[model samples]
Target: MLRIHFSSGDLARTRIAEEPDPLWETVLSLQQLREKSREPVLDGWRRRRCARGGRALRTLSPLMPSRGYFPDFLTPAEGSGGLESGIDAVLSTPRRQLCGELELLADHNPLPSEVRRLAEGETGALRRLGRALRDYHASVLEPGWRDIASRIEGDRRHRTETQCRLGTEEMLRSFAPLMGWQSPVLCADYPVERDVHLQGRGLLLVPSYFCRRTPVALLDETLWPVLVYPARPLCSDTPAAPSARLAPLLGHTRAAVLQALQTPRTTSELARCTGVSVSSASEHATVLRRAGLVASTRQRHHVRHTLTQLGDHLLTGVQLGRIPPPSASRHHGRA
Candidate 1:
């Protein structure tokens, strides 16, 4: 069990990551590739076939074993910036920290030849690690980035909705079955028994697409507190065509607009995704908002739209053939 103790100050500072961190996704996805979890959502990504002959798979395999501690430097906080920036941070790890983390990894598991150079802090070893990370992301992650991004965005949207509707603590508690929130401590299922006292640094909850079953944390508690938890499956980037009832009832373009909103998008962005003009997108959004199917928030000139709880349930139910036509008691309309 992993218990994360939070103080009042810590609670005030705690916040969810705005988007997926590329390095975290890369490292966790590599681990997922090594393991045989065979989750359906990952099956599409897995089919890409990470060939062992590939420099990325061979070089990175040793570090990301099926279990146990992986080096923390591999996923630096700079990852919040983007991929290249994150890789730069990984490559620029000070020798002292590099050696210490590698030593810790070695203590738990046998260090392979590829990683031994890193353990010894040999020249250019970090550069090689950087290349392997970039190569794997290009080969595996970049290809399906849209799908990955949308899925993570969907999870973030759900979290935001939860936080807005019910207080922050309620949002934390909503992670039940996966995690339990008992006031000061948030409990999670983990391979080891550990306690993380947030003190006052706060915790950054990073949602990941590939961190299946268990949440991951940095072995070194001194660094910023970060928890990478599995993101909830929302929808495929290119969702299946709207259900027969959905398309006919909402009309095709509006239905397409609704599907495009699985992840929040601005008016122009929505127009591009739904293949409609900007005005059309705006019109569709206004109607959906009136029906309580979508909630729109304006940020200067552009307005971002996301599915409301009613919209989410309606779309999900109709797609699954579980929802019937709405009655006057329940507010909503066609598209």
Candidate 2:
């Protein structure tokens, strides 16, 4: 079991990541690709990845093994910002840290020539790794990114509501079967035996679409404290595409706007995602808002639209899972 010890100040400082961490997802997805363990859910996604990832695999496979410790530097804190910044952070890892982590990896798996060069801080090897990260994300991850983001968003929203309705402590407790929250100490079943003490720095709760079995933490706890847990929501990784059930009723463009609003988007962003004019996107959001399906809030010059409860129901028409009370004991459920 991995135990995380927290202090009162740690509880006060604890918070959730604002967005998905791209590099973290990239690393976890690579693990999923190799294990092919999630069965029907990830089967199709795995197949697609296998077909397109040969070039990227040549560079990334040796660095990230099917199991055991992968380099913490591969998933930098900057990853929450986006892919470019994340890649930049990875490439900029201190040479000393790079060499040390690679040495650890080599203890278990033989490093390829490219990976060896990377450990040596060779510029060419670092450049190739960057290209592989980008190519892999573009080909393997980008396709399911929208659905992935939506799932994580749903999990975050559930946690946020729990925090507000009960309290932060209660929200923490809600993790339940996935994590045992017993006040100052949180516990979970882990692949390796380890303990993480918050030591007053607090913790960052990161929900991941690809993370499975057990939550993950940085191998190096000295970095900002993060607890990455699985956010399996709504559908499987490769759920068959939903038939256009809502499109005809709402009209194609309006329906597109509704779907794009799944994770919140500005009018311009909505326009881009739905391939509609800016004015059209704005108009649709207004219509959806008036219809009690979307909520829009102004942030400076941009208005962001998000699905309201009714809107969410209209879009999904499915019950989202809820974090059970600490007594539940069972891990995941759609309560």
Best by TM-score: 2
Q: List model 1 lDDT by residue over 177-249, tens digit each.
A: 3665667778766788899999999889898988887789998898999999888776554454443338788
Model 2 residue 177 CA deviation (Å) reads 0.3
In candidate 1, which residue ranges exceed 4 Å CA deviation? 37-53, 235-335
Clashes of 2: 0
Off by over 4 Å in 2: 37-52, 235-335
Query: Model 1's lDDT to the true fold?
Result: 0.79
| Alpha-carbon RMSD of each model | 14.7, 18.3
Ten contiguous residues with the weakest lDDT in model 2: 235-244
